[model samples]
Target: MTATQPAAEAPETAGETFDSLNPATDEVVGTYPVHTREEVEAAVERAREAARWWASLGFDGRAERLRRWKGVLTRRLAQLCTVVRDETGKPVADAQLESVLGIEHIAWAGKHARKVLGKQRRASGLLMANQAATVEYQPLGVVGVIGPWNYPVFTPLGSITYALAAGNAVVFKPSEYTPGVGKWLVEAFEQVVPEAPVLQLITGFGETGAALTKAGVDKIAFTGSTATGKKIMAAAAETLTPVVIEAGGKDPVLVDADADLDAAADATVWGAFSNSGQTCVGVERVYVHERVHDEFVAKVVEKSKDVRGGSDAAAQYGPMTMPSQLAVVRRHITDALARGGKALIGGVDAVGDRFAQPTVLVDVPEDSEAVREETFGPTVTIAKVRDMDEAVDKANATRYGLGSTVFSKRRGVELAQRLRTGMTAINAPLSFTGIASLPFGGVGDSGFGRIHGPEGLREFARSKAIARQRYTAPIALTTFTRKEKTDALVAKLITVLHGKR
Candidate 1:
């Protein structure tokens, strides 16, 4: 049993299991099985068998099936949203947004797989002149995914959709906090691919996740915190399996002197509080040019005061999905205020039994824990910068390099690129999360490997370079032929063609 397990869980047991809960009220949402090593190995064996069938379909057939799966998701969106809200205690609208974004990724990956993963030519270099060269992406047998509680659909769907489009069978182990959301998605997928178990669900805690990483699956796609990502990578390394890690983010937004203050304020509030701030790419720090820091801070504070977490239409946010998170939230806020930070809007009282009210802080030291660490709550730290360069410096100072935003009327794109992060959006917040054509992942402690666009397709598939010579070359270098004279002649020819004048 892991920290997420209920208190009634038996002490130190194997093969025992339990149910997932509704975070809002602690009700049993669904029963889940804690698979043993034997069961996990068997699931891998089954997945391998299913992967072969799936890969045999090639791009066209797989794309067609994925299209139907998308249609299934589209038609039954409301029912899925209900499950998402129940499991995670997020607003239904937020759940719907995640579902819609996931649907877009599924459609995009399906529609674009062939172009992204199809065979292509490559230069083999002068040393291998006798060889013809090409490369193509191939399925990596089966892939396992360990997902997170926030954005349960969109986050894991980023890997699942791309993996399926790339022709790999997937075994998904969603966060214990949102197992029902995972099960619902898997069941819906089954309706489209009724003849196969291309997508399998295994439910449990960290042990289940560890089993997946250690399984014979060729790769693992993990989305969680940096601490757990390290553990997953270490486990996968036992099998020398490749892993894609979408870990935590202490992402920052830089507001330039020339930026739009109002848009930046709205983006900051939403980016910080959506999902009650459980997003990996959610904004945690704000570095504003001193010329407009006061105005920007005031505007964001005003907007944040209106956002509340509940199951109602007026609620723009939702409760903390995991109870233990309440403690972590409390700690980060307390440490920030202790270090001279001032809560412009919400404070310690904002965190309640269920929801964490949107909290905004300013006048915090740059080196404070709140500014440097990922709070993963509905909190944002505002800091002033002497100039845009200082703003970028402060934003890039953290260990996380996931998603970053820049609000610059004149320098948005340039600033976005300069930040040491995987994806950066200009003017708006988390726009990269909405675009299917852009690859989503991060570097440094945030994690490596990609989850969307061409990079995503390649991540799920392996490059199988096929080089079939059009005909035997007159000069054969691969065999023990009379090649002394041939080698001399070839060297001379190469010098004549390639020596710089």
Candidate 2:
């Protein structure tokens, strides 16, 4: 792909910087220099050169380097978790879980990249019988990854690991709220591939990210809000840079009449309130069969009472990572209540200054903001549906179709197949995210392209096809000396071989 025109270097004041603040407390977590467009391009230029070196290392060589990096991550897992906790204000355990998941992806990408992307024999059509064909995936040079703060380590590595495995150097621009975690990752890479700029980090506000999009990177993999994704797509369009967007989602959960009520309630509470409900694939809406609606609601209410958000180790969840999000959570709950919804658990008041208590709202109008928009907080709205068909319909009605869950004993797979989303977990909450082999992404408003498994490896790669002539044909097809009779014979042969079709 051709590089974009040089980004106009924006002027900056000397010593301009930004502070990463802890959401749990109004304390500065870390301070980072505000990188400018010039700096971003310089990083990309270095990455382009580094990409050549990395790709030349080949699969085995690159895999070895990746293994070393993975070892570093494992040895320092606890230390990395501390940075994640300090930046995002999540529990230390949650941070550890995200880091462990990220390590797993690195392992999977290193072990499977060659098998999934290396050249392989491809079938030649009947007309090309004399030709041998093969296809392989090649790196897309340098890639820019703009990641989200929620699950900062696990979410961004979903792209970074695959891009590296596919042989592309990466320039990651993590969310400003979690720059400390990003810095930690880049610093750790130095302990492994210390000689090359294989994985670099650039920190700043949105302008820095925008500058990265306009930079001459070969591709951009972004995971963030739908609105921000649109802006990224537009900026990348200026250079025709390929992009893989993992945007916001208003995922749903379906509770069938035959579902295990106990399990369904438990999964719903955890799925909706985990990480303070900052997950892109979290369950924001619940559709229950009318027969078991009352029972499911009661169970969820009971399960949610114990789910509280605080900065302490004993808290089940943590505060909203982005303090501004508190207002949005409060507004969603207020709207749901004003629309005649009943708060069975925490109400609008539950959205505190730093932490948002697990709030469950029922009887909320389907078209209300709480149900319609992406309320990325620890809040869920449950609605009773006439049947499974209605449940599926309501689940598919939303513009955002990311991840969803279905609780059914017999019809688990059936309901999962009907819903339009990237992934679905049946009778469990968020099991897909743990599986490194499954592709992770969504369609429509949730954005397109994947970031895990084989699909992810291909997302940052370009498919190259090769056709070699194994033997000369008796009848020449591409020679100036070929006669008209030869052409007729070829046409007749094709007619006999495929005309009936």
Candidate 3:
């Protein structure tokens, strides 16, 4: 949430505290303060002051500081990965991959902010040819970031890095499941920019997040479930604060008849099961052309045979980071199997207390719970389509349009363009996420607003346009002293130029 008025004074201390637990072991990872609304108000007030000093540094100064902070993250990458693994139960390699992607966003935001948000000349219309026009993006002062636990580093930094680069101080509220990672990031940032509290951390459960919305920041960048996004929006409306929501997605993949069967199978398996299929953009439903449907299914099942989920080095993935999600996953799987779906890999039995194996279903109805709602687990459903046209129609039928993939040797780009998603990958799985130059977001129920590339830099900024007269016009239409003849001439000019069109 963004602030519109001065913040209230804060209390001396928060009322209570909470602990972060490891999902796999159910052990305490760390304990953090449960900040109250008053405490949240204090953080925002301090951030408001810090934003002023940060904005004064200008683009070059801010970029230099951000690069130094990036260096800290790069040098201590392994240590950070360990923290992520412990809290989220993800494999260390997966944690490192996400962190590395976050580092890329930092580099991109630092290197490109000046060029993207700096003032630039613009062409004045023919009617105002005597005036010079220019536009520049200014920071929104203080930004509030509510981060998600999955890919905690990469997803949140997509917003945090851009907000910082656009010259605003950020107040981050990491999910209760991943507070240590957030603390580590904020601490690293402080080491590089110790002059002020440019980045602040608030940790706790739903109450803390609710406090943040009422704390009166300039804008809020949230990444989580669609239900939570709606709540954030409703809270932000009280102050008319702007928000950017990157919510959950029941993404789909389209396999055209021309697609490479082996490649499509490998991509689908990896995209659907990676990170134990907890990824917001991970593939939940796959649409295969009838010609290669049997081949693709066989290949996917073969590839998924060795993929296991456990908290160990040898395991391909790790346990479910959120324990409660196991029931939801189980319910979806049970419903699918009961509704005439056949499991190609794991089934309802695969879902355990801590982890769930990759479950692939075929012959599932399009209206089943597994297909229509977000399972948010290591599960996917495959459906055969008569042609590419049918495949696309089935893919677009869902309410979510966050991310999608198209596997076609020839029609990759064409098919990708037709999907109503924020980002798409052609002939590959989740490739758009690694590219720093592309913007990442979603549409419809998946939530809206972007947080990468030029669009991201502008998300935390307010555009200001300026026009100034360079010289006096021969005919002064704007002046009060303009003659009736001049007005008649202006009307005649408009008629000659625009009347026919």
**Leading candidate by TM-score:** 3
TM-score, prediction 3: 0.97
Estimate the TM-score of every prediction.
0.94, 0.96, 0.97
Each candidate: RMSD: 5.3, 3.7, 3.3
| Candidate 1 Cα errors over 4 Å, as ranges | 1-15, 123-131
Clashing pairs in 1: none
Which pairs in model 2 have colliding backbones? Answer: none
Best by lDDT: 2
- The sequence of per-residue lDDT tens digits that candidate 2 reaches over residues 217-297 is 999999999999999999999999999999999999999999999999999998899999999999899999999999999
Local accuracy by lDDT, each model = 0.88, 0.92, 0.91
State the lDDT at 354 in candidate 1.
86
- By descending lDDT, how would the candidates be arranged? 2, 3, 1
- lDDT-wise, the better of 2 and 3 is 2
Which candidate would rank higher by TM-score, 1 or 3? 3
Candidate 3 weakest lDDT stretch, 10 residues:
1-10
Give the RMSD in angstroms, all C-alphas superposed, for model 3: 3.3
